[model samples]
Target: MILEPFPPALPYDFVFKLARDSHDLEGYHKLRREIFCEEQHVFETDDRDLFDESAMPIVCKSLIAGMEDTVVGVVRIDERSSGLWYGSRLGVSSGFRRLRHISPGVAVRNLQPCYAALGALGAGLIYKAVSTACALGCHEFLATVQQQNARFFQRLHWQPLENIMLHGLPHVLMRADLNHYAAAKKVA
Candidate 1:
């Protein structure tokens, strides 16, 4: 697929913040269904989960639209004493996915490049957990990188520690030391 150059400002909808509440939760579920269930074939999707009560949400907006713009992205973070562990079913519906990506709530790509971007930007639902981890002086972050996605994280400097089965998929235990990331100069 040819990648179109999306305007940065327009893509950002000129703002960033937490999801309002259960009010837009339907949209949130819709986006997740498109990516995690329909596109990647991840879960059978029972539609009920432990995180529903505690997870934080963040959304991206497209300026062309009105205030509610679009839910371009999302992430759910699980905070832990060892580190901040993050995961979520997310969709980059416009740039990637290719239409078929929004199939339903049972087939979709399990992993992608956006996770690291979410961590870096302090955006997405996962951003809050990342910040909380940082506040706790967390030096490292860990997650079960999908087997197919292990190479992607490796490219981003996350190191794999073990290959294991998680949620019916093979995943490599991966770690990211935020200290190294902090020392790197941000691109202008």
Candidate 2:
């Protein structure tokens, strides 16, 4: 009997970090517009708002073996008040979705990145945000997620507080359980 060779592994070294320079910042904005405006059709042309002026943006990138770094995902967090934080505008690249049969749970993509690396992209971003919030003395970390993504957050130990409408979309207000994700620990 003939045996098919196992597929070669995809190469990647993923990095999760805060936007440290103009390049990272510009990449983040471009990704947001690409996902939110052009792909999702949630917004007409752009999705920037006053919050972006103060929100801290985080990015997930894939370190290609011999290519430029690709930003595959992004999310923003802001402190609403003392010890209260909010996360929003979670976006993952379409390329990421095409790379792997990722759980509806995680999402992003580009530059021939590994499919496995994209699997944890969303959780990694959230973990970083939670860790940052904790470091900043955040008492509660909250986000309004789309209905389809509510269970994914639940799996990450976030509790759905209520259902609400935002920007004409169905969303659930969720709060991260510090007990479950305390330190922005890396996701395996």
Candidate 3:
């Protein structure tokens, strides 16, 4: 059987920074609407909720020369209580959904192994949010993942604590294994 070759090691520079200004915040929301409301139809019109008021948004932008620093992916995190944090609204722009296919540039050659394994834009965004939670001293990180994507979270070292329903849809309550996500510390 012919084994598939490795993805090309090309330049993949993108800024995975927290939304600090209105522009960043707007971009984050726009990406979320595009993914959830339009693409996934998870929301009727807008996905903004009470959590958005307190959540800290993180965005991934293209770092390629001559290209705008477009928000390619976004995820938000919020502390629900003492030592507990939750990540939500993890989404990537439709056009950039192929983040897994993009290899890192030479500058990121020393990135952690987890980045290599979870190489997609959406995964990277989640890693960033989780890292931020860890840096903020969260004892446990949680998220309600869509049922279909539960296995994807498992691959990223998240354990399903329970199966539940949210907004009339099946979902899984998951917790991140800090050990498997240690790489997030470096970027946090």
> How high is each candidate's TM-score?
0.60, 0.80, 0.83
lDDT of 1: 0.49
Model 1 Cα lDDT, one tens digit per residue, 28-133: 6777777677766776664437866665554443334434566656555455546555544434554532222121211111111133332322222233334444
Please report, in order, the local distance difference test score of every candidate based on alpha carbons.
0.49, 0.75, 0.78
TM-score computed on alpha carbons, candidate 1: 0.60
Q: Put the candidates in TM-score order, highest first.
A: 3, 2, 1
Worst 10 residues of 1 by lDDT: 103-112
40 Cα displacement, candidate 3 (Å) = 1.5
Off by over 4 Å in 1: 1-16, 46-48, 65-68, 82-84, 97-132, 135-137, 180-188
Candidates sorted by lDDT, descending order? 3, 2, 1
Indicate whether candidate 2 or candidate 3 has the larger lDDT: 3
Model 3 RMSD vs true structure: 5.6
Q: Which candidate is the best by lDDT?
A: 3
Output the better candidate (1/2) by lDDT.
Answer: 2
Please give, for residues 1-188, the per-residue lDDT of candidate 3 as tens digits. 99999965433667677888888888988888998899889899999999989998888877667343778889999999998999999887776665454545522631433254464676777777887788788889999999988998898889999999998889999999988665354543
